[model samples]
Target: MNRCLSGLVGILFVSISLVSCQTDEEIKRQRYITEGILIFKNNCANCHQDKGQGVASLYPPIAGSDYLRDKKSVICLIRYGQQGKIVVNGKVYNRPMPAQPQLSDLEVAELITYMYNEWGGETKLTNVKDVTPILNACKK
Candidate 1:
């Protein structure tokens, strides 16, 4: 009986540990996504719309954007913006996208996390630690 009880306790401990880890990840993802939504709304919604649908030919839709294929470029673009012409889901947009120098690396990570999850079909959190170096190396 003691051996059986010990085995059950071990199983319970393992289960709890797995659950704790999963919950921790979920929490981080939720926090990043939440902050990202706010950042997008305040900074990008004017051109991209609340749903990321963008406006006509002048602005590009972020929802289901093919440009998200290049995650690094997306991150850099957020920090330094874009200029000239770029194709989004086959549409051409040439307007200058103003850079947001005010956003910290962490804020950019949160925004990236949210945009990917919401529109790019990503399930992982883009941690600030992972984003800092990228931002530092941005050529734009």
Candidate 2:
């Protein structure tokens, strides 16, 4: 009975340790994704729609957009805003995209991660370390 109890305790301890053993990157990724969902819903959903399907010819569709190939441009558009005409998957969208000045660098990172994961077929996190400098360099 003693040996059985000890074995069970050891198993439980191992399970607890394993569950708590997430790396920093993993934790950051989870946090970014969580915040990103909210940001998208609040700021982006009206134009882009909840599923990233934009309105007919007025807004550009985010899901399956060929423009997503230009990660830097997408990042810039999100931060600094977009104007003039742009083409997505052969569709032309001339409406201006308002900048999200309320989003910080970290929030931008989270937003990018969420966008890429949801629409761009990416699984890795877009760390804020990568987003800050890009935002700083925005010409728009």
Model 1 vs. true fold: TM: 0.83
* Cα displacement (Å) at residue 36, model 1: 0.6
List lDDT for all candidates, in order: 0.93, 0.91
Tell me the deviation in Å of residue 25 in model 2. Answer: 0.6
After superposition on all C-alphas, the RMSD of every candidate to the true structure, in Å, is: 4.6, 2.3
Residues 7-100, model 2: lDDT tens digits: 9999999999997998888888888999999999999999999999999999999999999999988888898789999999998889989988
Off by over 4 Å in 2: 1-18
User: What local lDDT does model 1 show for residue 19?
Assistant: 80
Worst 10 residues of 1 by lDDT: 17-26
Off by over 4 Å in 1: 1-21
Minimal lDDT window, size 10, model 2? 131-140
Highest TM-score scorer: 2
